[model samples]
Target: MGRMKPQTLLLQSKKKKGPTRIISVTTIVFGSLILLLFVLSLFTTYRYWSQRSRNLSGNNDLEDFDEDGEKFDRPVYAILDTSKGSIVVELFKEASPEIMDKFFHLCKTGYFKGMLFHRVVKNFMAQAGNSQRVEAAEDWMLDMKPQNELMSTKHEAFMLGTSKDIHANKGFDLFITTAPIPDLNDKLVVFGQVIKGEDVVQEIEEVDTDKLYRPKSPIGIVNISLRRQR
Candidate 1:
């Protein structure tokens, strides 16, 4: 023990630093793992909350359409492709359930296709969906017999005019009013209103018409499509 060798001194120094270095490395690894786990947890929480918020917003939008004990989760639209132009109307199912059902059924079956806007009164309204009568005769009567009469006697009975029923005795005719007709409010069933392409309706209204308010040139409905709100 008189004098320690240089090699022995170096060995002792290495021994002295070994535990400290090991401790530092271990601490760094542990801290890094903890930090990574924390970050992952934050990301998971954020994703969960974001998804929940989106779900709640969608539910709130659906709730907005709830009316009179009926749920209208999404809006129904009627796109009329006429010779003049295209017109978009938003159907109010809650307002006129029976009329909307009939209209939608007719649209699906291509009933309105190639049918003329047979009746058009300036600043009043444009009417269509008289396919049977329109195609049957050139000079068809406006007060034609109800088409639904042959389908069912029960339906025909329901179609009889009543003071309280606006759609009474009306066939599957779709009428788009250019100006508000207060008297027709209770006398007619309005299933939808124009949301886009009001100018197209105006264009049809401005077209030359005969004495019976029928358009001189055929303004036929090429196609009709139904769309749901996004």
Candidate 2:
């Protein structure tokens, strides 16, 4: 009977352990599921914020614009004669007075003469400036007054803008959009739009460029001469 009693206790102990093991396994599985859900929630929130950040920074190609504003009639124009060809840009004084003031000063002073169209971002913009201080060395753009914050002008195809990008140090130069870049409306101040020689503008856009968008062959601004339009 003593031996039998010991054997009976052993069987009871084993039976108790069965339910404990089962409960432990259930709790571990529940915890694993909770952890997975938490990770997924974090991933979803990160994706949402990442997209919003790209839109705000104007760094992505996602396109949307509510208004580009009305077209304006102006009497002045800029002639950008490049190695590729001559492109005419209309200066709308009513649309952007402050921006035009800066543009005119730069143009009249021969700031763009012989400068390289240094960078081109496919489907975005083509930027031009003196690679070094040799061609457009004055750097007078640094002393210019602040750009208009409330300007309503929109950045459309062939439009000339003053933004060199937040990362760029040269606001002394200009850029041309190959397409309507509404994302830049807030970041860039538009001074003019191509009124003629759009084909020339497109030709520049199609030029073969290095990975950094520098033209394989130098495409330069031969001169930028401003004149009055009838």
Q: For residues 110-200, write the lDDT of model 2, one tens digit per residue.
A: 6778888887656667778745422221222233234443333464578887753423554566778786654556556677788888888
105: Cα error in model 2, Å: 2.0
Off by over 4 Å in 1: 1-71, 131-170
TM-score to true structure, per model: 0.53, 0.54
- Ten-residue segment with the worst summed lDDT in candidate 2? 59-68
Identify the runs in model 2 with alpha carbons over 4 angstroms from their true place: 1-74, 130-153, 164-171
lDDT of 1 at 157: 14
Q: Which ten residues in a row have the lowest lDDT in candidate 1?
A: 153-162
Instruction: Compute the lDDT for candidate 2.
Output: 0.66
Clashing pairs in 2: none
- TM-score for predicted model 2 compared with the true structure: 0.54
In model 1, how large is the Cα lDDT of residue 75? 79
User: What are the lDDT figures for the candidates, one per model?
Assistant: 0.61, 0.66
